[model samples]
Target: MPTYISAVFNKDTRTVEFTADNGDKLIRSGGSLAWLLNNPGNLRPGGKYAKMIGQADTKSGKFAIFPTAEDGRAEKRALLRRKYNDMTLYNAMHTYAPESENDTAAYLAYVRKRSGATDQTVIKDMTDEQFNGMIAAMEQYEGFNAKPETRKERIVHATQVTLSDGARPMPATPVIVRSSNTGEKKVTTNEHGALPTFITRQPGEVIELFLEESGKIGSRIGQFALQQASASLVFARNMMTVGGNSQPHTPTQPSKEKRTPLRYVVQPGDTLASIASRFKTSVDDLVSNNHIRNRNRIYPGHVVWIYGKAPADAANDGAPATPTRSRQASYSVRSGDTLSRIADRHHTSVDALMAANPSISNANRINPGQKITLPVGVEAVPPSAAGSSRRAGNSGNPQTSDRPSLVKPPPETPAAAVRPPASVQARDTRSREGEGHPIAIIPFSQKRAPWVEHAYAQARKWAGKKEAEISRTINFHSELGYGKQFTTLAGSSNAWCASFVNWCLRTAGYAISSPHPYRARSFAADTTRFSQIDEPVFGAVALVGTSHVGFVYAMDRGRPVLLGGNQSDQINFVRFNPATLRYYVPKSYLPFAQKELKETKLDELAATDLNAALGIVVAKKAGDNTR
Candidate 1:
């Protein structure tokens, strides 16, 4: 049997970390909100299972709260056995994890592949092993495990625990856990007839456990105790001390090398690369030690553990090391250079490499001649220092220097250089500009319909605000109302992108007749309100495929600049190719805006005056790389 090792919850990222018996660390992030809620199948709480014992609503949101992983997985099996027993695997997946919110086809394919079963196989006809395997595959597809980027997976170890077979079965019984470190806490047994197991325990710690009477929490009737050691758990029936020693264990002998753990509180504008470099370590060490999800996002007060030897002075007093800036480096891509190879060559991470260079949209693909900026604290390798690789390029040329040169920061422009001329500001509608995707002030033409102008103004108001974390925005949720639908949007799904557009349209007095307005494709489906247009116009709704929606701000270089939320996880400018997008304008507004659209080369006309009307200064920068 596989042993359960460790579990950690990161509130900031809303992700959970767990370790398998083979020392493999599994990260539940992105589309794995069900994992964080302990719901393996993303099961709805409103179903018949909600009436079962110990069922409760989540305090954080509308997601169903399962007491344990075992219970959640068991509930998934129960759900499949009860309702989907007769349907084929493919047909069941369509109803269980619908395409309206989930990638149902991908879910079906993963289950079929993992279980070695066909899509036409019925759930009730499968063997026990195949059924369990199919359920495991479904959970894995739901984001229970993080996809490894490299060939060899990194490993970490944690203590393992197992309950003895002789222990009496207890269901819905609240277990009170009292420990020396953390105070007393009550954990109830799951309704799925599984006992709550404890995996995160320190060595040689004696924990007192009490069973509540009448299954009511905090009403202790009988007491039992368990002693926890590394990979060992000894349970006693009666109130008896398993370990002889009552006082905490202490070691009198001192080690030859003084290696004490050190912690550093993150300061503003600090990256994992900078912190690692300060301690003479690598970015991977900092990320693994701290369990950091997004290397680019570290808050001001977060405490990060520094591995290896501490500085002499700081180790004595145990004071946090002072913050200092690390020098940035830049590298020129070689013939066989990849982001992963470069990250391995230097003592940095692929995420750090991407953080330094924002323009790199894909890590797998990069041109040979592209200039790559190394993250802070990483030393860059020059062409000449690359040895044989460098000589091949400059074999005949003698003018190029062999010595490495430092990358210089961009020269700051004077205030006068950025300020628009007085004459331009007087007549230019885009005189004022804010940072990000629609890089200039939103050009709201009076010639458009009143609602179009209203929508433009509404989109402009939220042009710079960003989600604090994934799918988290106070004003957007407040306007849309946190309903059951938003709970299904997890992982890479853009939960609020459509809601942001809906809010903007609704706030501007434009009513959506569709019942499911939160879904992005709904805007394009409502033929009465929206009509597809070939020519992009100001304030037109642009639908990129089916997952995103944003308002067309201006035309720049044959591309339509869009102002939408969830673009790089912020309400900013995003440029989409004209061929890829389906542009739509309100039928009511098309009549009024046609005069502006009559220009044969509307994109060219907007490129010169509409897109260039505003002077821009970057006030803030968005960091997330997702849409």
Candidate 2:
């Protein structure tokens, strides 16, 4: 009996390689494997499938290839199960199915033919070899490999571009779609204002679209993620003409009744019941008349409708009623004479005074000498006269004694409070660079901190140097007591990538603390102290995993260009995939160079003295208990 072994098909080399238990390597071309697959009965005398063109080696207990029909089928079945699930297979079929008038029916027919079964045959019913062959054919047709690419692709689902006037579709409008991970593509709209599919994209990747016309450069329309199988977007200007008319569109005017409602502008501390009481109406009437969504949500300055009759003078074309001596009193507005304050003093509602003084445009801005009319003895209503007086008021007239007086004593001048000088006022000092503003608002030529520039300058001096040179430099700095300080901070023989970053920072006048300035993991763990940004910034420390650290020099082709040591045993600039980046430690967290200890003073300190001083400074920065 011959022993059967599992084999892997290498698509790149076009060869099949298998390993036996005795560590012997067996090799065969893809063409030979295909032949053996088709012809299974041609076994050699040594119980091995004879090579098509090579002599067979008759070593003791040497493994031989069994016919695929007898053994390879089982191995292929297991491989398929491990590589693809049912959903993945179905999705691939759906994505790569043939284009036809009736796609669903055509896809079913294709699957049936490939599986060699009836139309009703399900994928689960097909043999593993049949499923694998069908998938392979589909992949080839789609022009993609079995495994998806790590980089993202852009898939345009739908686009609709319209003219600035919106009178017609914007045909031939140039559109650009860019993926940060996969570059960009440009296309123009067709006559129907529809964008053509440019590329296949994976879901969750972000894409930005830009539109251009005439000789003007493109403006960004929007940025969105490819979350669905299809996306529908429309790009249009803010201003547009009405229909096809030459005139610019204008909003329609509201109806007269809606424009002029019998409303009371709410005052501070006024509630639904208080408003209704002042209007001599019920809360239910107020709620129903205004369609108030929430009775308790009415705030000061909000206008609420009054369903019942307003004063007789209030009926004169929405103008404030001129109060006669019998019904009102004049009050002089003094400093700090708010409508609410006047209303409270006169035992009347702000609505009543507003109804009497229509000349006062803003109730809150009444000048000290401005004369305002007040409803006198109107807010107070006896229980017996409430209903009848309300009815009379609704009839456009009411007894003077029925309501409370809105009149009050003239307001007096208010004393002004003294203020502190500008120098004594507290202010925020946090650096606002690259924050609270659009990315475009930040200038490309913005100045960096002195320490950041110095750190980058130091790193650039050793660029392209290998481990020996880096080690020699490290030893030179260590002999000056820096090595003893670092060893006390981090253990010996540890990876020195983070140590190099800290050394550059410290040499450039940044004060780095224990654990962090030595260990990469500890530095990454101090996330709260440093701002974590999504995009890499120049001179910022880039953390890869919890081990490697480097300074981001620039962005090259959507990846971080890093300058760090211990990368391939060298201090060189290298491009790292954005996916490998774990965190970006912002340079803004480091103190300015001018704020660091003087270099002459630092040079005189011993290793122990420097460590003790650093510990005290670290504790103070962290607000730790020194005792």
Best by TM-score: 1
What lDDT score belongs to each candidate, Candidate 1 first?
0.47, 0.39
lDDT of 1 by residue, 1-627 (tens): 322233333444455444333323344555446645567776765565521211212333344445456767887888889999999988998998889877788788888999988989998999888898998898887765543332122222222111111111122334555655555555443211122333333444444544544433332222222223112122212111111112122324322332234555553345788877655558887787666667765533245666543344432211223222334668878787766557534423444466577797665568888888775434564343222321112111000010111111112321111122111121111111211122121111122322333333333333333455323423343344333324433334435667667655544334331323556775665442345666777667788888788877656677987766666555555677888788775433443334446753333223223212222111343462337
How many residue pairs clash in all the candidates, one count each? 6, 12
- Find the 10 residues in a row with the least total lDDT in model 2: 396-405
- After superposing candidate 2 on the true structure, give the runs of residues whose Cα lies further than 4 Å from its correct spot: 1-452, 476-494, 586-627
Q: Give the CA lDDT, 0 to 100, for residue 611 in model 1.
A: 19
Runs in model 1 deviating more than 4 A are 1-463, 469-473, 482-484, 487-494, 593-596, 599-626
Report the lDDT tens digits of candidate 2 across residue range 318-404. 122331222344777777656654543433334446556667544445788787775432222212211122111111110001011
